[model samples]
Target: GPDLLTFGEALVSLRSAGPLTAGGALTPHLAGAEANVAIGLARLGHRAAFAGRVSDDELGTFLLRQLRAEGVDVTHVVRDPGRPAGLMFLERRTADLTRVLYQRAGSAGSALGVDDLRPALAAGARVLHLTGITPALSAGAREAAGWAAETAARAGTLVCLDVNHRSKLWSRDAARAVLTPLAGHASVVVASDDELDLVGAPGADEETLVTGLLARGVSTVLVKRGGEGARAYTADGRRDAAALPVTAVDTVGAGDAFTAGYLSGHLDGLDLAGRLRRAVTLGAFAVAGHGDWETLPRRDELSLLDSRQPGDTL
Candidate 1:
């Protein structure tokens, strides 16, 4: 049985290989918010599992292979023979800004159904990680994400929600309609400062947003502020973690990395402050490297960050 289970869409990201243009060199990389978390957890010495749908195409096969290579169990993943896998294009103009274009309509991932969920597998996990991106895919995908969360909750598994709201996926209103109710089922809620609108608290300050989510049955809320740092609020009180200093290469998957680090620390019996520290540390690592899951640090690799010398040893 896996320690952590996550359900969502995994897509192939085609990024600009050379120059920025209409028809520039493109490079393919596997990416998905939830999948990235699963990979990160696995890298951090946790047993993680992924549940989602992908087509029986080359891209789909490649994604599955990558997940297994990262030690993420893919037994719950469905390979739909009819629909193709989802795909997205990422344009990296700079280290801080990235524009993503999605071509995932009617894709296998968007067709995820409740029947695709293996509740038996989820029941063995300690936490079920979810993201707002899957629900924004389609109605079926929305239902599937909700079902997985509810199922895990019923089995006494903690539900962790990441409101990774994407403007390209859906409007703020549409996102709120689905994400708010879904968040009520989660034990923990994670959202970026700009994405607090998903919980129907648009433009509200960090304190207000945290209070709102707590009142909505969420026991804990994490507000992620890029570069500035992150804050966590619980019934007991609140804690903060400063962002680790690093020269950022790409910031696209930093949140997922943070979530993975947080979950890994939680499962390892770390205190709230320790979990938050691990989260910020991994978030910094994500930005310092290129690619999504590829940049995540393993448990042993974390000490390398403590090195101040140029030529450091393990």
Candidate 2:
């Protein structure tokens, strides 16, 4: 495939290893749900392009530099005169706890609309990857997200939506309103236990949950659970992956990593079970690193995690 287009915001994140008052190393890096997936696919030697609005300010410039540095096509990124790229503060507690404080309100990314969608993306994409965060941004962004999904589907491209439920961003009713309809346009929908609850899926069980999404028109639904593996369902049946063991670090972008890996597998024509297994493994690899994109492994590095058996020593 020649194209994988992801639409969302890119933030200028100030990352620290510990509590803010206590003081830790502050590093500037690129951060975003879709941006993470773009970088992840690029790391795996796939074609990934990002489409979003960024401020013409310093933060926006930094984000562009970051994505371009990783070989992501950034032709669709635009800078607004009045708005700026969003900001986030990432604090790591212990090795596993990671918290983010957001400062994105009416930021440039959130201000994007359907008219801003690049014609190249609308016409040339092979897959449309989106998340729950976009529609929550604002009315314009929500419309742009839906239009992108619909356009990609009409172009015969597979649409993959990650139902990444973020409570701080918007209300359950609002999220359900936007997500339920967009899910109808996707061939595959990815979500977690938390996302399922927010949208009022049929039941807690995978069968019922996936059935609900299928009724909404998503043929493939994957429910991801941290450290507990993932359950994947299609028209045929469902399959599960055994979680891979890894020492946890920051938990910020593991779900995004899972989206990156599983979608990569999906594009490569991997089986349902194989895609879930790869997704879980890739997510574990993401936790083993420092920043979001810094730790994402290339295709060769991904296999190293599975080299060990149960009895093997680290």
Candidate 3:
């Protein structure tokens, strides 16, 4: 019922029974940062679409199937028969920990351009969710991410920007230059403490950093601090709450889950504190599952967390 479209990479993931995916991992659920958020939103009963580049090869098709299975609109997902879908290796370090290694080179996700931006932000879509990783993929992909922000603004969709800074992909200066401007156009933003540091506020306190974002035009900022809980600042107010306790599991997709929760609350018109709690619970659930996209809880399950024991209701 909402106008939400999230754009980013979707790669086929392999879970190796052995140490790694140097041809030893078992095939598991396929997912990525962008895919996880899109699926999460769809599962929350919102009509979501993913707009990004994917290879036309088998892996690309597999990615599409997963999206469709999760009820995500795949029309905006373009296939590049000339390229191949990227692949990733996720290794379980322990029952509660995992290590990931990337092998995404020459993947079709790098072929994005400005044209893909407008179509995905088509009429009826109210938000365009983006991450910092897409811009790090390639020049064209970066342009596409920028275009998505600009196009979404032109279309009147709120921009939801997540500062997922992967230092392995780009330098701090490069990240600040690209992400800060894109963030300037967003009304809502999510970032971890470390990411905000890379965005040129390497030593600013949480309060000042988030306030800086509002000064730059963003109305809402959610700073996610693992274990310590998360804090949200809005034009109306700010709130700090504890993260839900759970047996810690894989940490790969926790941030994405937090994002999904906040966006769901945003769509539902929940207040600041209500949104923070939902975000925390979903993050706890993400690490509990083995695979990234596999562990994502649907709206029903998330609703259950809001029980009668003096809990916040959606």
Q: Highest TM-score among the candidates is held by which one? A: 1
Q: What is the lDDT of residue 167 in candidate 2?
A: 84
What are the Cα lDDT values of the candidates? Answer: 0.87, 0.82, 0.79
Worst 10 residues of 1 by lDDT: 305-314
- TM-score pick, better of 2 and 3: 2
Residue 53's lDDT within candidate 2 is 91
Score every model by TM-score. Answer: 0.94, 0.92, 0.91
Candidate 1 lDDT score at position 118? 64
Candidate 3: minimum summed lDDT over ten consecutive residues — where?
A: 305-314
lDDT of 1 by residue, 1-314 (tens): 67999988999988885435757788888899999999999998899999989999898999899899999999888999999888888877654577778899999899988888865344478999999999999888898888888878888888999999889889998999899889988998998988877786666777777777888878879889999889899988788889987777788899999999899889999999989989998898898889987878888887556545544453
Give the Cα error of residue 185 in candidate 1, in Å: 0.5
Candidate 3: pairs in clash: 3-125, 3-126, 15-26, 16-25, 16-26, 56-80
lDDT of 2 by residue, 85-179 (tens): 78888877555667778889989989988877866464577778999899999988988888888888888889998888778898777788788
